[model samples]
Target chain A: MKKILIITFACLISIGSFAQGNVITKHFADYQQDQSFTKVNVSSKMFSLFTEIDGEDETEKAVLDAMSKLKGVKAVVSDSGTDGAKFYREALSRVQKDGSYEELMSIQDKEEEIMFMVRNDGDIIAELFMIIRGADDFVLMTLYGEIDLNQIAKISRILKISGLEEFGKLGGN
Target chain B: MSSRFLIYLFLISSFSGFAQTKLIKTLKEEDKIESSYHLYPSTLRMINLQNDPAFDELIRPVKKLSFSILKPDVYTSKDMHTAYQELLNEGYEEYIEVVNDSASMFVVGNESKSRTCILVNNDEEYYIADLEGMINVLKLGEVYESIANQDTSKIGLGTVFNYVMGENNEKRERAKRRKEREKNGEKEAKKESFQVTIGEEDNEKKDTTSEQVDSLNAIEEKKENE
Candidate 1:
């Protein structure tokens, strides 16, 4: 169990360099997406996520899988520990108005440890959801955030990818 | 009521009229919902729950997973006809399922109209090289809620469990469980399963329903495993 968390944590070493400026007009010409930055250097893949927490004690891989498929990502890494003590801090902040809360039975089937790293095209997007579950404990954490979509546009322009501009304008129009 | 008054009324009517509504004109949306979604079935049992015949047909051809690397599951059955018939009801009128072997996969939702899909795989054994490798299945402008909210009701979400159980030679376990149940004279009631999401607002009620629904097979299955 410890080994899994360690490996997942190591993979999450890239998610935090998203603190800056880059904007580009929509590109639909070359079907270009991920037009944000020319180069991406993530700091802490897990910490950079804008996360939400729901209060409950359940454990499973479904939650992890759900977070992995979120967009604006190119990769992800997950691992965790059994630290139910951590839940109090996150749930206070993670609950949302969308009724987006996913629940679990309890910390019963606890194999609790999770970590993830992710990006889109090439920029760090979200590194969400991690927990540590023991036979009687669980810790849940999540992150969500918007990447520099504008930078994605600029990168597409620089690369001169066609159709990206058109795709971008699909909504901006 | 004279011609002059009629002209005045016509002018007023023309001035007061609102722009005619057009299908394309109104849907010209700026804040468009990307409508992206992803699904990660627990395991291969999900195939049985498929309720879509075409999805089953897609699975039928795949006898084995030859190799791994850049692998993804794509269901090519244009016509979904299966015992579980849920896809037809949930708007998967035409779709595909991409199986990246036993551990992972990529699916495109409603291939006919909007592209969407769900993915599932093992993180510890296979996801060694790339951490976010599993997410390659997601497309732009997708929402998980929209797809799963509609699909899981009919087929059931035990696909993941089925997958895990399946990997461990679960058919053997299930058969054994069935025998044990027969020895004990246990009969499964209400063969026609229905998923009724009774309450969303009240937590207690939902919990109560969840508890009541844990049937004997489930209870026995847990005890036998232990």
Candidate 2:
């Protein structure tokens, strides 16, 4: 009876932890298991490389400065082959129930919608989660560690990376 | 007057009048278009944005906000880039420009004063915003980010215009009130009332400066370690 009770308690603890897993880890695992999703993981060390990317513009230097503070970034994109709508809905619900995040903004057009959420420690944003659900595409991106949208926007501008400038509207002092 | 001078004046006046008439006609047509929207400070303040903290500072200092959502394919990528180049040629200083796979954002501002203009175009639609007053160029990203977060269909461009105007009005009113109180010889009263507020602002500025310093130090340390 005692052995059974201990095992049951351990199981409950594990389940609870799983339910409250790190936002990126929970979704990233799903991306890995599903062949339909494209997962892109850029570790902290790799983020530093953004600083060295050649660009004559001053914004390039700003991007390097911003990338230096970044810890990690993970993105999961669903193509036409995947049930993107289903993944979008599930991810949205999961983030909604997750206590660690605060919904910052949401925009929708026709059948497409995008949501921005963040986990901040005081003024410092630790994580930024973006969910984009379109008619044919769905994307989930989570950026970790002192994430500053201004710097990210500058980086995007310098690198000619489309759609990243939208993150700059995330709000800062 | 000489016959030649009379003839020149007649031709110049006629052409000027013709050009003015054409300009007036174009302005009237634009005003009649239902697709366009205009918002003032009073109308903007009335919009309830659910008091979202993200917009707390983003909307301030905006004297006006106006945008028109154009249909897809109306302006090709080449056309957009050409227009940006024209603005540059016209001596509009480039503030910040971002060209990505999906869309592009271009900003231009005056050398002196706070007047700014932003143009964002994608495959589907294009938008233009004219903002007055002091606006931090860096914070424009946050403004765009906030816009990206909203339900464009539900909120429409009107909401953003109104919100910005409303915040601008609020700032104006506060400044007006302060000016009036000062004129009434209530300097001591004003000092007492704004003591805490001024202290808080000072502290906030100090905190921001310190954080930037620390971040710079961290970057230097990382470079050394590398």
- Taken over the whole model, the C-alpha lDDT of each candidate is 0.27, 0.54
Of all true interface contacts, what fraction is found in model 1? 0.00
| Top candidate when judged by lDDT against the true structure | 2
Question: Tens-digit lDDT track for model 2 on B12-124?
Answer: 11100011122123334544211334434344444534453423333444455444333332445665566567656655555444343454566655433334445555443
lDDT (10s digit) by residue, model 1, range A86-172: 543333233322132323212223344332222233454433322333333432322234433333333223212112222233123
Q: What lDDT score goes with residue A93 in model 2?
A: 84
Judged by DockQ cut-offs, the docking class of candidate 2 is: incorrect
lDDT of 2 at A5: 100
**To one decimal place, how large is model 1's interface RMSD in Å?**
19.9
- Candidate 1 residue B126 Cα shift, in angstroms, is 9.9
